[model samples]
Target: MDTLEKEDLARYNRQIILPELGITGQEKLKGAKVLVIGAGGLGCPALQYLVGAGVGFIGIVEDDVVELSNLHRQVLYGIADIGRSKALAASEKLSLLNPLIQIISYQQRLVPENAEMLFSGYDLVLDGSDNFETRFLVNDTCVLLNMPFVFGAVFRFDGQVSVFNYEGGPVYRDVFPEAPSEDQRPNCEDSGVLGMLPGVIGSYMAAEAIKMITGIGTPLSGRLLVIDLLDNSSQVFMIAGANPDLKKDKEKSGTEEAYAINLEQFKRLSDLHAQRVCVIDVREVYEFEELPTLALNIPLYELLTAQLPLDKILVFICQSGSRSRMAVQVLKGHYKGEMYSLGTLLFK
Candidate 1:
């Protein structure tokens, strides 16, 4: 650990004085490398505090450009930053805030192809991405890399924060095994999040990151903190049963390239009577009746144990695209025919 310089002591005097986080903890923060996913609402606030606290190496992964509308909640950018890349803009501002720290900006989306490579370089990850696909990808990548991450999400008046993949604790998959269907899951654009919601949740996320890095306080590893700012009510739910499958190596798991089909493509396939396409709804039994499409109901929990037909093309469907993706993972090597996940599919 590098000794705190005269300038470092002055800059971090307030936090350095805390007995729980004295010189040793401050030094840990100075040596820690944290990668924050997304530079929007949640990422903005997280970046501010993490940098402000003197995290040594911070990386920003975002492909979005600042827009006029993003100014409301994305606190890192200003009027002059509109049309600029979010990753670059955030890195520039964070560099100015903490000149002593190193900031690496990747102005690209966090796709499955690049996730593993990017994650290998960081000690911890902070997920502030708005979409479930990215969230799942981050969770899986972290689990694969044996890295812990702070997860935060804000929807309207409600926000949630959790720590996952920490010391064999429960992960995002243990809580939300599947994502809510497209129509059921609304984005900030459609539903509109309160401007202050992300700030509150992002700050909590930053706190979790610091705790994980410094080993000072108990981190929310197996619990989900749900906060309703509207009523100021908060609840902590203990998540049970971390999925053992997530711990499997990606190459050995055979899920590196699972096939996916959209609703339109599914409809076209159904219309063609040539192929034996079997659509399977992997949601719970109670959710089976609510689906608009005709399909066999095989809950995701029972998928691996159930003897599925191997001759037919299997198409998995769930309320949101999450369960279907899990189903694809379960049936990857066992099934001989082509498989598909109706990920992020919205049925009219």
Candidate 2:
């Protein structure tokens, strides 16, 4: 698979003839190892292009099954694929599209436990996952491994595509620090997409992946490309990476990694009320009124000036955990005591 065969030379002659991509670029694609998460709307089209382009090896991770509702956007599957595993079905179709490439299907969910191991072997990752949790997991795992991943997401009539953690560029966390509350997050099942939206976005994702693999053109590393087919408009916005100095200080101090704890952990911490543990709700006053009395109201905007409980274990909470995560980042070097952002359980 390292070198293109005679059949590959003819099959890819169209692309290989391009001045930018000659035999060298085509060979690069043949040697690339890509892993795609999900086989749904975005994944379907992206996988098709990558497979057709003769990417040497591709791995598909999908735990879901094909459904009638998925037919509109998940173009890889057919009516007969309903109830069949998306990973297996997509792999079969993609293999037929290009027998020259190797495709592996993993019929399992991508969780923290398996994400690092699954992503380690691939040179690049294309995220077609729909959920915020999976998206964040993909970002975190990629960041930890120093791997590059192409991110594509579609909602309603809008779509977004970007390459994160590429060559020390801005990562997903630099753009979106935390996931929105479940109430605010809606899927295609809750709010329908334009049927063709994923197709367009997925194609863009594949293009970015190929560009990165073959060193063809610029990849959207620090820029987010937003597409709105409704108005026939597209925009690319430059995103700034998070402060590296603060991260360096934290690591240099040998402090534990900062992260949000789930609902169960938050509950266990609540029992330590008499042990100098303080919960601070960083939401605005109006939103904080609905929260339980156990948490003290200290809006995020006032956190820098307000002071007290320096020796206490500080736990921050907010409506969706976004502001809370920011709060912890704000106080990273200043707070020496134990601190954490409570995951979005209080608002749930």
Candidate 3:
């Protein structure tokens, strides 16, 4: 194990003064290796705090370039860094913040092919990915590698932080079994977000990492912290361990309704009543490169005014079932037809 030097002692004197995290905890942080998934909103703040804490080794994985839009939240970069690779730019800035630690930059996307190899080298992973596909991919890969990860996500005025797969605790899948496809909903770019929201969530993610590394406070394993800036409130929810029937339990508890059915049920409806069954896809036109033959494209926003066959059994579909459910609700009394929402169980 590597020990902290005299300069390190001075740099982390404030935190080291804590009764729980003294010289020994500082040494643990000095020896820890943490890999962050993105250099966007959440990653920027988390990286800065972790670097300042003297984490010995840190890796940044990002394929995006700095854009003018990212300036509000990604404070690590300046106007001069526009168009620069996020991983490289963040690495350079973090190294300047703490030259004593090592920073590695992987200017590439975290795809399935490279995920396992990259994840195997780190003691822990901190996911700051924006998309659900990447987030779920990270969780699955970490579970396969038997590694724990800190998860953070930010929306317009809301954010969430959690520690998953730690000490045999609940993983991301335990809480969210399914995710919407990329086209299901708009991202921060489309929906807009509060500039400082990621900072709050990312700081929590960094604190969780530090606590896990130093063995100081209790990590958020099996617990999720949700922050809502709009209401100026926060709440922590406990996550149950992996259960194959978690989704079923949710549906049984009335979280999901009878109007929501799986793909198999949708297919059966289409097969049994071919002429009477109609599938309406409530995704944006941009989301589809080529529309599926089975469904008609009707973006959620235009669904209310769209013409539809009143005699047909309507099945609404989207990247995730969220918008589809909304569609069903919107057309319930208006459209005199049997309606169903094919949630995430139905894919492109």
Task: List the global CA lDDT of all models.
Answer: 0.84, 0.84, 0.84
lDDT of 2: 0.84
Per-residue error (Å), model 1, residue 261: 33
TM-scores of all candidate predictions against the true structure: 0.71, 0.71, 0.71
RMSD of each: 10.9, 9.6, 8.2
Candidate 2, number of clashes:
0
Q: In candidate 3, where is summed lDDT lowest over 10 consecutive residues?
A: 238-247
**Candidate 3 C-alpha lDDT tens digits along 1-348:** 688888998999998999998999999999999999999999999999999998999999999999999999999999999999999999989888999999999999999999998898899999999888898999999999998999998868878899998888888876556764556555788888999999999999999999999887889886667787987877655453233365467767866666878878877888899999887787666564444535788966466667888898988876656567667756756787799988652544
Candidate 1, 348: how far from true, in Å?
16
lDDT of candidate 1 over 225-326, digit per residue (tens) = 778788787766545333344435444766533366777777787788346887788765645654555677786656656788878878888766766766
**How far off is residue 233 in model 3, in Å?**
0.5
